[model samples]
Target: MARNKREEILDVALEMFAAHGYRGTSLDTIAHRVGLTRQGVLHYFPRKENLLTAILQCREEVNREHLQAGHAHEDLPGQMAAIVAHDHQLSGLTRVYGVLLGESITHGHPAQEYFRKHYATVRERMSASFAERWGDRLPSGLTPQAAATALLALLDGMQQQWLLDHTQTDQPEIIRDVLTVLLGSPPVK
Candidate 1:
């Protein structure tokens, strides 16, 4: 019961956060939606920032699960396309991620440090993966680090665009196409 309640609160909180952003959502609102009092919510998460941390961790775990489920052995472009396809199915989580990511840029935001560290780690790992697959530079003639940076930027930009207008384009297909241009070859199936 306790675990279920906690997960219930997280689900409600994530939806609210996705709709209203972290700064716009409040603990009281989340508690009310979860059929808990403010104190009840506090019992599970002592601070609002703690709730944010948990949500972010949950999102990362979801992404990790998708990657581990046969996506890990693929080439970089294939892995990224798989991730985008997975995200397309989880619109709520994607919205929350986009909201939190945009808000994390504000001064002293709780998620700022987390985003910084996350990007650094992802970029480094992505660069290493690129190097492993294509030596020092990609077939597009960009260094592994530069290609990694471009790939991340493209993925983020595509997500933001898709969030604003879901009818705009097919995200996974576009990603695969652009990645082909960047990689100088089509992504392996």
Candidate 2:
């Protein structure tokens, strides 16, 4: 079907972009990888920037689904743990995003708007979640926005470290430890 082919092209292009930086990936490479001619690929994505935008949009949808699934759990810590566990269980998509997001900091990167909007939306949703969970018990000076930003930063930093040294490090444990310190609770056993 037409939709299936479009999805296939998108998947292949995402893998290519993740493996090689955006500047290094080409429509020709993506077409060859997807077993399509350049013109065929162009039928689905007229421009490389369009393909990049599609990839980022798909990633945001997938991440929002995953986070929402975790949020269905009973408590904030449980939700956080589920999210962290899901990260460890999945392929390196999160790591790939981390790399791309870092690269997007350069001037005129194609994904700048995508990454900026992604971070803003994620921060707002997370802050709302934290406020819903701990509004009554939060320390007098604490703010939900600050807590959300800290949690996101911690997760990003921990995942980067895990990607660098998965053999010697346990990412979920480190995240649990950090959260325990922040929440003044015992670490997950």
Candidate 3:
């Protein structure tokens, strides 16, 4: 019962955070929507930042599970497209991630350090992967570090666009096409 209530609170918080951002959403709002008093919510979360931390941890675990499912091709391009497809499928989580990521850019945001470390880790891993796969440069005349940065930017930008008007964008296809061009190879599929 305790775990269930905590999960329920997390779900409501996730949706509200995605819709209103961390700064805009309040614990009172989350408590109200979750059918709990603020003190009740505090019983589970203790602090609002604690709640945000839990949500971010849950989000990371979910993404890690999807990425490790082993359905996508083992290659980098295939993995990249698979990631975008996965995000499209999990639109709610994606929205929360996008909203929190944008919010993290402001001064002294709670998630600022989280996103900073996240980007650094991802960029380091991606740059290493590119280097191992293609030496110093990808076929697009960009160095591995540059490619990694550009790839991250492209993924984030495409996600924002999809969130704005998903009907107009075929995100996976676009990612695959752009990746093919960037990697100087035929499309993954």
Best by TM-score: 1
Candidate 1, residues 1-189: lDDT per residue as tens digits? 999999999999899989999999989999999999999999999999988999899879998999998788887678788999888889999999999999999989999999999999999998998899889877889999998889989988999998998886577877877888898866475
lDDT for position 96 in model 3: 94
Of 1 and 2, which scores higher on TM-score? 1
- List clashing residue pairs in candidate 3: none
Which candidate's lDDT is highest?
1
lDDT of 3: 0.86
RMSD of candidates 1 onward, in order = 1.6, 2.9, 1.8
Q: What lDDT is reached at residue 83 by model 1?
A: 90
Q: Which of candidates 1 and 3 is the stronger one according to lDDT? A: 1
Instruction: Please count the clashing residue pairs in each candidate, in the order shown.
Output: 0, 0, 0
Error of 2 at 94 (Å): 2.1
lDDT comparing candidate 1 with the true structure: 0.89
**Residue by residue across 67-108, what tens digits does model 2's lDDT show?**
786566534555566676676665456555766777788889
Clashes of 2: 0
Residues 1-189 of candidate 3: C-alpha lDDT, one tens digit per residue = 999999999999999999989989999999998899999999999999997888888777876787788754455567777888888888888899999989999999999998899899999998998899889888888898988898999999999998998794467777877877877755555
C-alpha local distance difference test of each model: 0.89, 0.73, 0.86
